[model samples]
Target: MTMIGAQLRLLAWFVIPATLLSGCAPAIRLDEAATDRPIQTSSAPPAAREDAPAPHRPPSPTPTPVPRAFALNLYQEGDFVPQYTFDWCVAASIQIMHNVIDDTGGGTWADRVQQGQLWEMARARSSNSFNGANPLGWAKVLTEVGMGPYAVVSIADYGEALRTAARAIADTGRPVGLVMWRGRHVWVMSGFTSLGDPDQFPKFSVTGIRVQDPLYPYGDQQWGPSPAPNALLTPEQLATQFVVREPRRWSSNLPTGYMLVLPVAKA
Candidate 1:
């Protein structure tokens, strides 16, 4: 009985120390789901911070572009007449102008009867004793025919003169009386081509003009091919015949350089 008791007491001492040591240390628990929890992360990228502000952006600017081309062919509308004689250019030009604004074909200024009347009226107001017709006289007659408020615009620069003429014609939808041959001859400006849109008038530049030279082919030696009545003339080509008015007994009162019988809006 004493030996059995001693063996049991030794076994109890060993078991107690092992149990106390394990209890003093940590307890380890095994979970089958723990490994999967770490690997089960989302496949999507990380979301942006909720408190972050958006970036700023500036506004786009507005556009203001010029046009490519523009033209107004009044002659093509059958509102032009050819001169009967070299000296009758003023009368013919006036007659053609009358046709344009004369919406009613009352035959008031049509044919030789009315043309002769206009010629005589122009001659009566002439500044030159030599030539019965002149720019001043032409303006006078035009005023009498209700196309008044016309201006005798003269510019030294050919390019500026073209812009002025283009703007006038575009605005009024009427022809401009171009004093050609050093103020000795007259031609009608019926249309024009522009680098910018002529329809935008006052805001464009002239590139070319369509002239209704009454003397045409007959005066080709003096003015190039006055082609088909309303001939397209470049600034260079026009400069050939559109020279400064020579000081003459007739054109003494006229301004030098390029001149035109510009029609203005009636006040």
Candidate 2:
């Protein structure tokens, strides 16, 4: 019985120590930052408070981007007549060669050549004949239009002219060339080709082909060499022949757009 009592006393001592140790455990504080203050409470004025002030959002709609006007250093000084880009630059060139021999208008080939009228008026006096009609007809039309034969076409490069026409007609927008394919002759380029890769330095380039074919007939009705020859004129050659021809006389200022007549024969 005494041993049993001793065992019971030992158990009580152990239980008392465990209870006292647990009572000495550290206290963990929660909700330390919590406060009873109302969410809206503030000392500053309503305007000065960050939450009270109204948000200054950017104005409703963004301004629209205005399109840049077409501009260039080259400008037309004389008078202007409408012209087509591709047909005149290409097909008309072909017709010009054909008309040279067909004698369609009783040796009036020169007249027909100048019939381009308002069309070829770009090159001051030089481009006039290429337009169509003879020098006399051109003069008559010039009088009628109140513009002299030496009128000026719009100040524009071949590329600009083509783009304007293409846009008007809903074209795919390819830079067209006045491809005058023939055997061997002086290449007269009046059109341009877009530089395929716009990222390149030169965004566009010129291509003027002279009308010469193996079958191309001279004034004597004699056949030339082979037909459909390679490009006869390089850009430099054309520049020397066409662009540099009396450069001081007329302004080569290329405008954003130009005018041209669709060559009737090619169409």
Candidate 3:
């Protein structure tokens, strides 16, 4: 019985120590600051990669670009008239202009007698000492007879001169009278081809000019051949015949430059 009691006490001591060792183990230490922060649980999508194409929504459609080229021409059949005499260019120009403005083919004025009469009238109104009609008289005759409200305009730059004439024709829908051959001749600007439509594009430039030289097939000895009616002339081809006016050729307050018997919009 004593031996049995001794064995029991030893076993109890072992069991008691095992229980104490497990129950008294030290707790793991935690960082206080880390523990105080809230967990991030936002449902936002991940950031897109820099090189990724835009999401399923298609990128805004690029605007449809305008056509890079354009053209406008007002010439039609029977719009051309030739001068009856060498000195009747202005008169012939007037007839052609009337025909152009009278697009309906009503009252075409290509009569030779009328041409002679018109020439005499222009010569009488002009004061060019050489007995030839000048740009001022040409403009006056156009205005006086209801074909006008025309004006003589001079441009310093050849290119700008062409632009102005083209713009005038495009705006007024009437022909522009070019004072060709150093203020000695006349040609009608009927139409033009351009990089952009003059009415739409601000920076439009002229690519070709349509001309009506009353002296067609009978071009001057100095200037080159006259282009047929409604001929599309390149800017370079036109510069040869259409030159700056010799201011001394006529009396005027205008500075020496390129000239035009420009059509004015009626009020």
Candidate 4:
């Protein structure tokens, strides 16, 4: 074979084999720009969590204020009756009670006598002497007249008695019979005052009391000066006349202490 022909045959043999091998192999591609960028491995996007804590909120406002002090003066609306005789205080007090409660459809009794008759009836019922009427007798007479259903509360604590009397007066709008001076005399409880509002009486401390004193300035010398009718009396002043449990000189069966005639529901 000629030399040129032999050289061309050898080149064709090398070139054809290389082209066939390249066609059989897989192609590999690379980008220079891709190597410069940061690799992001995660598929999820950035977002706030649903369970995260909420922002702060302002506090709620306070409720309405309550009253701290109060006073109830029932004396101005009540009737005042003076006892004719020293021992007739209970009768006189009952007369006053009748006058006040009569308008409210209470005080239904055939024996609505002013003083003498009531005194007699109380004395007879209680088995009391002519000296004076006893608390039991007074309460019994009031109950018999339909003016009651009265309770004879004998209490040793003065403050408790005062509270009870005030509550009774406020609830019934009737005078409370106060057995004063260790059962030597009787007075009426008409009203009261408190450190807290009167409407919230159960929550307050009683500061003062309005009383109807039948004896007034002319009380027995041994019992101290009687306060004027419908007088506003301090606890200290009341303590002067009011005493703890003591036996009575007239009645032997009566219970001792600060006694009161509290009206209750009929039957």
Off by over 4 Å in 3: 1-67
Per-model TM values vs. the true structure: 0.75, 0.25, 0.75, 0.69
lDDT, model 3, position 109: 88
lDDT of candidate 2 over 126-163, digit per residue (tens): 32324422222222333343222222233246454334
Candidates 1 and 3 compared: the better one by lDDT is: 3
TM-score of 3: 0.75
For candidate 1, write residues 1-267 as lDDT tens digits.
Answer: 999999999999999999999998655444645654565577898988999898888888877675778777666456667777777889988988877667765653448677777888898888886857888889888888787767777788888889888888878877889988876688888889988866554557777889877676677564555656777888888888877765465755555668888988776
lDDT of 4 by residue, 68-182 (tens): 7667765645477787877788888777766656775554322435478998888777645555577778888888876787878777777777887777776676678877876
The Cα local distance difference test for each model comes to 0.78, 0.31, 0.87, 0.75
Number of colliding residue pairs in each model: 0, 26, 0, 1
Q: Distance (Å) between predicted and true CA of 141, model 4?
A: 1.9
Q: What is the Cα-based lDDT of residue 220 in candidate 1?
A: 56
Candidate numbers sorted by lDDT from highest down: 3, 1, 4, 2
Model 2: lDDT to the true structure:
0.31
Off by over 4 Å in 4: 1-67, 104-113, 129-131, 197-203, 248-255, 265-267
Q: Which residue pairs in model 4 clash with each other?
A: 245-257
Model 3 poorest 10 in a row by lDDT: 25-34
Residue pairs with clashing backbones, model 3: none
